[model samples]
Target: MNKLNIDSLNFYFSKSTDVNDICVKLKSFQKKSHQLYKAHKHREAKQIALAYLELTDSLITKNNDDNCLLENRILFLNRLCELEKNHENYDKAYHYLIQIEKTINDKPVKDKINFQHQLQNSLNKAVIKNHLNMPQKAIEIAKETFKENISSIYYDKNSIESLSLEADITKTLADSYILLGKELNNASYLDSAFYFYHKSYDAAKIYDSSAKSAAFKHNIAMTDVLMARKDYKGAINSINNYKNTANSFDYKHHEYMNKAICYHALKNSDSAMYFAKKLIHNKKDKCRRSNLITLYNILSKEYFNLNEIDSAYKYSKLEITSFEKARKNKEKTFQLLYNNDFAEAKKLNSQIIKQENVNDKNKLIYIFSIIIILLLTYLYLVSKKKETNQIILDLKNNNVVEKTEKVAYNINEDFEAEILTAINLMEQQDAYLQADFSINKIAEKLETNSTYISFVFNKHKQETFKQYFTKKKISYIIDKLNTDTTYRKYSIQALAEEIGYGSSSAFTRAFKKQMNVTPSAYIKSLSK
Candidate 1:
């Protein structure tokens, strides 16, 4: 063994000591939070407030490990969220608490037990809405909590017991705000949504929540141009805010969409169509299906006005299909109203008029209903058959299989079990998973187009390589970023590139597509 000395160990430790720096950061966060309170851009202010409140950790650095900071940590964290309310991005306000939970566990202190559950509850409320897809609601929650966190300067709880209970309640209130904001944004209420997002940003900024003030500002600037109907100003502002941030192309698409809509409002059909087409053909995964659908509908109307019947008809069909996919869920709803809302409404109105001839009216209604149901069912069956045929067609295109087996397993050399084991071997070795692991890399190890490898992995894993790798990347980033200061070196774009994306914008769009939260917000969770 090499000779080791206490002097050398102490010297190395001193070089990395961050306690003083942490204190300065903490105080700065506090000052910023209070300053933001006066601004009352409810969302923005709250994030600033949080940026300050999270500085409590300044007292607990460098293996000093005083258990006292736990209560204060919980306090600042919860307060940060309380201030954010449900300002669209509020769910992120509680992300810091998740880190607090892990830290407390490491401390092995029973007194901090309640804070753990409180943090979990906080996270449950503040997390970005994926299943609900409710952006508008998220905004509302973030705005409210932000104010609360800012205003409450005096806290009476002194005992650990009282602190624990208060933390839980505060955590819940903060989380509620975050959840609401996410829903609001998802609803396309971009202006109001961003206002709330600012709230979460303000609160998280004060404390160690994943939410951040800068990110909220970036989103606000972006959404204002795209969703608030303030085209020229929004576009100009977004360019400034997004210049250093991630998602430039996707962000620009929103501005383009807004301009397209503006041109349509001005009766400039050519300009309108140009922007609409750009949105439709955008390679960014951030393209909202709703925006595209609306654009298609508008384009068809414009073409109709120009007497371009073929173009009109084509776009109209696309609009109908988009609706069928989004609202009717590819006609899985099979509701007559979805198929023919006006006709269904007229039938119901007519039923009242023919009340005197009850039997005939009922018979006619029944016949119509039956016809619609049959038609819908037939469409559904045909769609399924077509889908089945598509798989066969794809196999034929690849020339991988000889006969079409509609119900057969996706078996080729691609989905073999041996391939997955090799991939899993690499995954298990890492402390946290790496998303950048490619089929080619795995194949190289096995001495085998990662395409075939991924095919095998997914066939065996029942997920695409992108999906599996992305999830792994997300899971690792989420956990590691929360507490590891060394991670600060990586930029938001770097996160994507590290995870095998061609560029930052692609990674960001893909992440939002997969995880629902932007890269900036995700990074904030770490420092929070």
Candidate 2:
């Protein structure tokens, strides 16, 4: 069948409709379609858009003599691509994008219109690849053009088209870099992501409110990259500086969520809970269900830490309900927004299930070990307390201060004093109790470097940083067991949570390495 002649198509739309008339009609249709889309009338909006496209399509001549006609057709094609992408019709979006590319390539010389069209094609194609969970492909597509045109993009910031394209491409590169970095566990990729996010912000038009809002969002995303790297202090500092910008951009909910996460990372549970609860009570309607689920999960954990069992249970149930609701109400229109992330999460979940299935025998053995430990714990607690007191008394009588070991070499007086003071401050402040605590964090707080902290532990403490820190924290747990009968009754998991370990297995391994005794053995011996 022959394709219909575009010149003869008419439904109150003339065969001689000029480019300006077609554009005006297209814009009006777009405005109405957007309203319908927001109202969740996607079918009606799609039908209207298809009907409107027929008129817009007829304006372009086959010869491509009219520049205005070609430009208008390119604009319509880009709009259709966006609409299809939003609908999660990736194949259709790709088809429209291909047509757009063909139209742009049909023009031999690189005029202003041709240049912008080429950039639009590159940006759309890269974004589509990203949504398909092909970060490497997205990176390749973006870099192919971005590397060549970067100088031109930077210098053409005076024009809206150039500035918008630059901002869009840089942001896409930033997102691709961060996603790939997280998947590969490569710090260099995260650094590049941050650099590009900053570039995106710089390329944004200062006076355009919409552009500035996007820049603020890019900055917020950079903080998330910092948190992923376990740079909690850096994340907190970033939130403090730009949190207000979120309000100006009508993104106060995002500000609240970021602040909650940062405070939780810092172990300031009270502040975390304050911000989280504020969002739930005041701004719940304004936030996405997925985000609310995250807030609920955070609240549950924080309340559990505080031993507020009722609040913990409440939020835990809320977390489950929120998750189910989010899944059920998943908006297809925004699928492209988180398609790569969702796919990645699904892949991780599948791998975890497969691993669990393969390790069934080890899991059984672990369960039996836990049962034995529980049985021994019960028997020890039932034994006579007089024997326990006698054993403790004997140990007290035999206790003496052990001689300290000398460092590997004589250190400078100033360096020695500085290191000692920093160690003392760490102990006094109980910084080890933070969930995100690390040698790097301590170094930052002490105004030194990780290399120096690692050196101090090795030379003065006769251990690596992990060994030294583990011994210090485990020693405190031992002291608690000796002094408080209630502490001894706590399960290994509960004890681990109390002491800021991410998991009971991690705590157990550290305790055994430091004291040469399993936690269960230590608990039983104390009771005996």
Number of the predicted model whose TM-score against the real structure is largest: 2
**Which candidate achieves the best lDDT against the true structure?**
2
In model 2, what lDDT does residue 20 have?
A: 56
lDDT values for all models:
0.52, 0.70
What 10-residue stretch in candidate 2 is worst by lDDT? 1-10
Question: Stretches of candidate 1 above 4 Å error?
Answer: 1-241, 244-250, 284-286, 328-528
Q: Give the per-residue lDDT of model 1 (tens digit) for 99-154.
A: 65565564545643554444343334433332134433433443343344334443
What's the residue-level lDDT of 491 in candidate 2? 63
lDDT of 2 by residue, 199-251 (tens): 87887745363454765676687787897687888987877767556644455
What are the models' TM-scores? 0.31, 0.47
